[model samples]
Target: MVFEEGRIKQWLINYINPGMAFNDIKSVVTHYTALHPTKETYIFNDGTPMELVNLQGTIPVTYKSVVYNIPIIIWLMDTHPQHAPLCYVKPTPTMNIKVSKYVDQNGKIYLPYLHEWAQDKSELLGLVQVMIVTFSEQPPVFAKVKPKEALYHPSINNSFPNSVFMQQPPYPTHSPYPQPSYQGMMPQAAQSGYPPGGYPLYPTPYPAYPPQPSSMINTGTGTIKEEHIKESLLTAIEEKLMRRMKEEFQQNQAELDTLKRTQDELKQGSLKLQVVLERLEKEKSDLDKNITVLKDKEQELDKAIERLSNQESMDVDDAVITTAPLYKQLLNAFAEEAALEDAIYYMGEALRSGVIDLEVFLRQVRTLSRKQFMLRALMQKCRQKAGLTVV
Candidate 1:
């Protein structure tokens, strides 16, 4: 059987997260199905029903040099890779599940690979490989013994028209009394110890009931004469009781194992929850501290804004007073530098208009330039002292 790509895509689309890409999922599904075609079905997970792609097939496992096809089912969740897929042994009716550390009595599989799943690393094929290797060491399932049907004598068999005594040849015997033979059956292959029909003969539950003459049968004297009949009946009853007790013991053992697993899982969940709670508490404490620091910073900002708003607009000279001595000195130097620059420019204009002689203009420009250099140097020193970068 082959899985249709379109159908697989459709199933993913319907169940996967809207923003999650399904390329990995599709690839894994297609690749696995190439070997074992899987069936897609809907199942409830933790009380929430979801449509998922699952494979129900036998995986080839080798045990003691013999290869066995171990039936299994693998479920891929919608949020696969981010989470581990569920796996279980799906035994046939004639097969009984074998419980081990990797596999539970209920047939659920648990593996280190699954527990350590990483979204970037884990995939369906890898999980299946792990299962194959684990099961090879100890097969997850074994065939059950087929029950034998009750045996009866040919005299009793002759009463039923559907009895095999009519068609099948009789088993060889070394009894003192001659054994009855069929008239038209194939010769018994005594050496082979099987009839020509190739069916193995089963030993009777008890020796043949003594041949009943019509007079003894009619008089009921021949009934229950063989003590072996009573012994066989008691033995069959005891065997049945033992079989039933064994089944009940197995069932109870499985339940106990299931409960133990559940307890371990619950303990793990509780530990995780406790860790998360502690982490949340730490985050909350940090947030509270941050809120207090923010409130203090906010108050400082509000006070600074209030102070600035209350001040009236003022000239640069008026605003520069009554501050640190270094700041005051720096502002005074800047003002003088500006005045000297303006004086030099106006002197040049006066000379160009012939309002002043070149000699006077040159002298004035030289003096202003010298004083401006001094002011600039002083400003740089004051800025450095104030821990500000010199511009």
Candidate 2:
């Protein structure tokens, strides 16, 4: 008896989705039917009992009780000839007609066969007419009774009832039914028509009393009328309405206050966001300036490298013409230099291996010495530009 509204809503959602196939519908119906048994008759708005009758169909369905013939319509929607054929007991001949196709202004197409046959008035018109005719022909029966009057009264004497009085009740010859006892004189007055042990054949009719005046007069005073109470009731109702209006106004004011608070919060949030965005823009400008400075420094370093390369090329030409003894001395000096120690050692090994001539080896040594001098000068210039003393 306690239906879960949420569960039914979920079922409806599943049913209406276009993606749900026939099998899904069948399963959903089966589950619903299991929860709601068929033995119980579901009454429709028209007071008709619905019995579930499963018609033979491609889709396996068990007929549950139908209420207001709704199950028949449901079965038709499930399995029609165009989609899936459904067979039912006592199938009407008029139901064989194919349903009409209806399309909405939205261009949504609904095949007549897709809808229930009962839903189509044109299709079920004759059937409904036939049903109405049959029902009218055999109307339900109701009981009727007429009031009887007492014509002649009969008397019964218990004292002489054995032979003389037993032939019949003494002459006025009323029915032999016993009379009911009266409240004040029960044993003597039995004219009320109910017997001692038997129930009354007819209920006693109540005597009608004359209506009283609407206004009542107080002792030696003016009359008090219902109008006073009516006026008071109306006044109370007006006061209640005024109170309700005041309460509604208060509620409206509270709602407006809440809305104003929300608006204030939103405005504050927007202002904060604007402030953050401005700060971000400033940071972005600063980063762009830093990037430009780094690019300039890179350009300066490239020019310095080009100058050192040209100077080294000139130094190598001069060293090639110099004496070999002077070259050897320069080599020993280059080996002792901390910065060029690794270069000197590798060059010495190459010369010893006969990979290069003495002239080429002397030139390379001179080029390396000039490059080291240029690098040291560049480092000192960089330190001076940065306002740092070179050690």
Candidate 3:
């Protein structure tokens, strides 16, 4: 939908003050003007007769011998003065704002002045004074120096209201008391410095409201009164900070304990794995030794069988020339006995040389002697029947 800029500009002229315009038809948010005809943004509403417009400005501030330019924004909702204007501080990109009692990390400034705002009694000048005072207590942290290009604005050089400049933070420590979070949905405000209260294109019919009085207005109030507010706000902030620190300490302690326990479990698991690995290595070595001994015994058995087969073939060839069948049989038996004797002699030699076990060879010797004696008796009987000389 098209907006009636001429009518809206005329309406802003009739309502706000003249000195707030700061010399041109426009004002800057971050060294840039919001006065362009296209910059006027509206929020569509189904119920309201008029739409709310977005207005932003850079409010110059000086604190602790340092000049800082902070941005303040406003949304002029239709249901205005009865509801407080949504006030926020948008620091430069190089600034790091703390989330404290008064200003949130999002740059939201919560002051009691909003609830006390009266349509006729309150002006944008008074609220700006509160913002300046609130921020003075706890200035934002600067990450780096702001760019020079952003600092070059005509509005930035313009002198701020003396009333805003005069207000101080609630403490001697350069900080304000921790105010509670903005309770709920915030309504918007019309700033005298911006279009609604003052715009250069349209002349102002109403003279400036001469600095309206606010509940937080710093009128000096004497030394005792200033000390009391500072002390109370300071005490409350200290208590809140202490509580937060304690909670963080407890959380860190819990995490450290959990990490220590995990480290201990890992150490135990590593020790158990080492023990199991050592045992497996030892068992493997023993099996290797046993396998070597068995292989040596197999080699000895193969040699013994080869020797026995060679002796049998030699005896059979000698017996083939004999004519008596009985004598041939006797001779074959005697050769078998001789082969057994040779086997016993080799086994004894192996045992003495430590190639074979002594007790194991002794057991085999008794078993072989019985077989040798039986073959000797059979050879003698065959020799007697054939009447062959026993050689």
Candidate 4:
């Protein structure tokens, strides 16, 4: 739970950047937490052995000179000094998209910055700023939004010709804006000579002129109408682009399916060929075994015929044959019983033959004592055969 002073100082440096603009987040700033888990049961939570920093903020992303505030959460993992943090875009529940390369239907976003994370020099604030700017290139295709109402500041889209007329004051207003009355009253005042509150010193009055039409202004600059046309044009272009993208996606999907089907067929053919190859190998082995059996049987038959032809001499060879069979049987029985020491002998043979690696033998020998394994003479013979050092 304790954080080293050096690590904590490095983390605190992420609060802001002197060179970059950091959009202030409304979420409450929280203290850092570190986890060191000794049990697998808490690996994802308390048992984590790294520092995890969680950041919640409205990431300011700009598109077409307009700014949008996208809410997101970032998780800096324990390997953060060496690993990139996890980022998630959190939109309102009702908003969802059907398709996007990075942002999911739930508005969770993925960016390329984390993919190329630099452990030695990477900082959290710098990373978030990069992500915010990257989103401008391809804003999320919203699943739902009002046609005119967007999450962007509306001032950029203002179509008024005279900006000064509609400029907002630095304070809030409680009522609707009053209509412009000066245009209508200007003509009336000129006709009455001088101003509405006439000064008494001026007895002379200008001759009354013909009254102009009382029709209100037209905002003759056509700024609002021009804006409507631009909006319509943009909508048309967007629709066309969407259709083209859909068409391309379907084509790619179809091609992928065809390739997948071909791959599956090739795999099936390969499996069949493998089965045929295995069957042929088994048959070849069986044929070789049968040939060996037939050769043995043929030798036995030849011997029997030979014995039949030499029946008269068979009695003369009986004394020699019986004595040889008794000695051979005694040797075979002894060999079988003495084979109990074969494992250690094989080890010695393998060591001498270089079949057992030196390092492996040395490691195993460290666990083995001479007295526990063999008689002193046998041990000496094995050691001599294996070229092992005296212990």
The runs of at least 3 residues in candidate 1 whose Cα sits more than 4 Å from the true structure, single-residue gaps closed, are 15-46, 148-391
Best by lDDT: 1
Models ranked on lDDT: 1, 3, 4, 2
How many angstroms is residue 184 displaced in model 3 relative to the true structure, after the best TM-score fit?
14
In model 4, pairs of residues that clash are 37-47
Model 4 lDDT per residue over 1-391, tens place: 3324354445435433312111111112211121111100102323333233445435556766766555455654444445565555544333332224455433444455564467565666566667667666655432243334322324323343332222211211111112121121111233335344321112222222111211122345424454554554576466556655655676688789999999999999999999999999999999999999999999999999998898765564354442354344444433443563465566667888999987876665543434334444454554455565634
Best by TM-score: 1
Clashing pairs in 2: 50-66, 50-67, 51-65, 51-66, 52-64, 52-65, 52-66, 54-63, 180-194
Q: Lowest-lDDT window of 10 residues in candidate 2? A: 141-150
lDDT tens per residue, model 1, 144-257: 432222133322322323222112111111211112222111112453365555222333221221121111111233243345445545654665566556556766887899
Q: Which stretches of candidate 3 lie over 4 Å from their true place?
A: 1-7, 10-51, 144-391
Cα deviation of 281 in candidate 1 (Å)?
Answer: 31
3 or 4, greater by lDDT: 3
**What are the Cα lDDT values of the candidates?**
0.59, 0.37, 0.53, 0.45
Query: Model 4: how far is 254 from its true place, Å?
Result: 10
What overall lDDT, based on C-alpha atoms, would model 3 receive against the true structure?
0.53
After TM-score superposition, the amount by which residue 7's alpha carbon in candidate 4 deviates from its true location, in angstroms, is 16
